[model samples]
Target: MVTKKLYYQDQYIRNFTARLQKSGRDEQDRFYLVLDETAFYPTGGGQPHDTGTLNGMKVHDVEEIEGEIRHYIDVPAEVHKEYTGELDWDRRFDHMQQHMGQHILSAAFEEEYGYRTVSFHLGTETCSIDLEIEYLSDEEMSLVEKTANKVVMENRPVETRWVSEEELSNFPLRKEVSVSTDIRLVNIADFDYNGCGGTHPDSTGQVSSIKMLHWEKQKKKKIRVYFVCGIRVQKQLQKKHKVIQDLTDTLSAPQEELNETATRVLLLNKELEKKNNDLKMELIEYEADSYIEKANVQADRKIVREIFTNRPMPELQQLAKRITAKTDRILVLLINEKDDKLQLVCSRSEDAEINMNDLVNHVLPVINGKGGGNNSIAQGGGERTISAEQLMDELVDHVKKISGT
Candidate 1:
């Protein structure tokens, strides 16, 4: 037998008694109990399922399986003739507020701008309504929010009625219903009429208020609007206020002056960063000149090889480039040791008769690393298995062998 949905009968039914019609375990061995009647709302249509206690056992999830509403739990319930099902009122009420608020905001958008809501998602923190239109400006969104809040303040009655296919033509439906039979429509005073199976409040005022947070364009010329309602709106406000208050204290400015203060600080930081970069470049040039002044000639090629402790790889590469640029007969082999890692840089002047990639290939295996480059410059490194001095010695010797002297 189908479980009688007591929630649709009376949305405020927190506690009820029902008979255990069936009980079994799924493929995953999760125990589930079906009842003759229940107030638990199953998960469907983007609204999450109701969670509460069934016969004192925690009901974590509820879903419809073959016309029966199964209350999935960790443990099976006691086989009593009459079982007690208690709804978690706080969670139920929060969902009610959000669902009802979505209806109002969606109707307002349609009523004002003809933007029909194509989708709705009731999330733990926020609710989103995907509209049929693509672009929605801030001012346009603000107007819709104002209209929705007006409906909430009006305290319009929220009514529901199940009508037949012939009776459907009598009312102004916002869109077509999903089911032809057992068609239920939620009516909001003289404003909105739409098909929905979700729970809602008795009046629009219970939704408290509707605030549009943001909106974005979707793939198919649709716009998704994110918003909060009732309790969530208050929570969102509190969170934002705390952030603003923290910023004011940190910047030593008032709330109204925080933006200006932040912009000024960012500009000052940019200027300081530019000056630091200029100083670093100046030091790199001086270091390059010192390395180039002392050179060893091997087979008529000036070889500049050095091992740097705790030096950056990029700076070493730049130094190698500077040295090679000064003379056509120069070959530069550089190794930098940073922390536990070692890096090597190899480069040569244009007229130098050697492919640098070959030198890098010979040394990469020694450090257990990988690298790739063209004939002009090649570099690679891995773990610091050996000291920078030892790595440099091996690299220079390989270059000497390539020189064939």
Candidate 2:
């Protein structure tokens, strides 16, 4: 078995005694260095590796390939001439805080609710633990967070020790041992004891704080919990405080009144939308009346027609539909100014010889544009060219020819 330096001693952060075991090139041409023992934690047990310097070279990644701990480093041959290594204490301490926090939380869940943590993952942003229970309600989660933080403030000492296979068999462990032998168990005093290989704080108090972010049901028998610990808890509180202040300022209300103010604003927006729809329908009725009165020939034969308006495109399309419903032999071409562009709408009578689809194919290219539609109606919008009147007249002439009117 490969010797793990951290497994035996967790406090020895920097040393010059570690010997270079092997040096070779990987598949990517990058050099991989192995050491007899290392302070660098390998990527395992859902926790990332520790990064530092090995033999004066920057160690970028450390991984456990098979049973060997391989360190990927960037360095010249001269740097490897002497034996030296350094551990990144800041990162290592953060992992310690998170890992110990997990122990406290896992134990609290089991002690209070009889929930067992079946799986745990330590990520860069947040850590997660999957419970054997199907679900944890919001009330239970709030209680768990409160209890976990209380334990952190209590600053209980965290202890670790190696027990023989026989000793481990007698002790009351929270979970069954998965490893073969020489089990190193971390005990959060009076709270939790589990088989874990990840680095952790010397005491539960070093965690500072623990916050349960949320939980979700993963399967019929599993629930996943997301949480942060130590400095992460402070960051979350700072961010939420700023958001609440911003909302209070924007709504011109007290922080306690922000929710009521937001609800009122949403109700007002809904009322405005209903009023706008009523106005659009009234505008369509007025436009349709004028177009029907001005139609020169109203018969069973197809009649191509055009209308120019300053109204919006949606209103114009509604007007065209209203006009088509009044005449059995009418084809309508309509245009309107909207924003900075011109909108077009074409509607064909059921008995009309011309189809809007054929007319759109003929005219869209004239305006250096593209459009498509079905047999009854087609609509498109494009950049304005000259006046609305001139563009409308040109389109009407094309429609007349296509309809054979």
Candidate 3:
């Protein structure tokens, strides 16, 4: 059996001696080097593996398969022969700070609120824990963070031990014990205890601080809490300060008046929306009045046609429908400002024998466009290259011919 030294004693490991037992290629055509012994911790338990140089080669990843640790490296073959390994100390210590902080926070939650940490994930940016309880109020979370930081400030010694399977029954651990017969457990004095193989700070004080950022209800019985520790807490505070400064400058208000300024901006936007809607209704009403005044009154059938100006498509379409409701022999055209596009709508009277679809088909091609519609009511839109008056005249002439007037 290969002896993994780091698993039993994480603190004593600064450097180590190892032999390259074998080398092989993985499925991805990358080299995998096996060492007789290593201080590098293979990724497990939701915590990432340690990264450093192996034998003068950059160790990109470390993984465990069938109880043997394999190091994935990126270097030419000549360098691998002169191998000397180093661990990333700053990264390792940061992991230690975060893992230790989790123990204290998890313990405080159980002690204060009787909630258990059901699951946990240690991400590169932040760490999160899912609790058995459905929710935690902001005030309660503040108390929890305050209590955890108090433990850090007190600087309680953290102890690690190897216990036999039978010895595990004597100590009360926060999580279920899952490991081989030999178990490495970490204890935060009276505050917390758990079976963990991940590296941790020697004492609570080494963590420096703990900040619980937020929490959300995951389900009826689960709440996920997000937190940062040590250097991450400092970084988070800096980010929040920058955001507040930006808000104050953009709103042109004092820092204390930021919230009120934001509320006023939102209210002003709502008032503008209401006024815009009222203006649209007024334009639609005016277009309908103009269409009625322009109706042809000489023939047996009355025909009304008007080209609308200065209106959005939606308002113009509403106007067309209103005009059609007032008179059966009506044709409404609207031109959009941006692209100079035109929309046509025609309603036929029973006495008028006009096929609106055929009329639109003939007119659309003349303006390098395309359109289609039904017999009584037809509608289409096209580019406004031709003058709106010329287009309306062409449509009126076609309607008059089709109506035999």
For lDDT, the strongest prediction is 1
Off by over 4 Å in 3: 1-8, 12-17, 75-82, 284-405
- Full candidate order by TM-score, most accurate first: 1, 2, 3
lDDT of 1 at 320: 83
Which stretches of model 1 miss by more than 4 angstroms? 76-82, 304-319, 336-341, 365-368, 379-381, 384-390
TM-score of every candidate relative to the true structure? 0.89, 0.75, 0.74
- Pick the winner on TM-score between candidates 1 and 2: 1
Model 3, clash count?
2
The lowest-lDDT stretch of 10 consecutive residues in candidate 2 is 74-83
Clashing pairs in 3: 55-83, 55-84
lDDT of 2 by residue, 92-113 (tens): 7888888888888988898889
Model 1: how far is 243 from its true place, Å? 0.4
Worst 10 residues of 3 by lDDT: 75-84
| Global lDDT of model 3 | 0.78
* Cand. 1 Cα-lDDT: 0.89
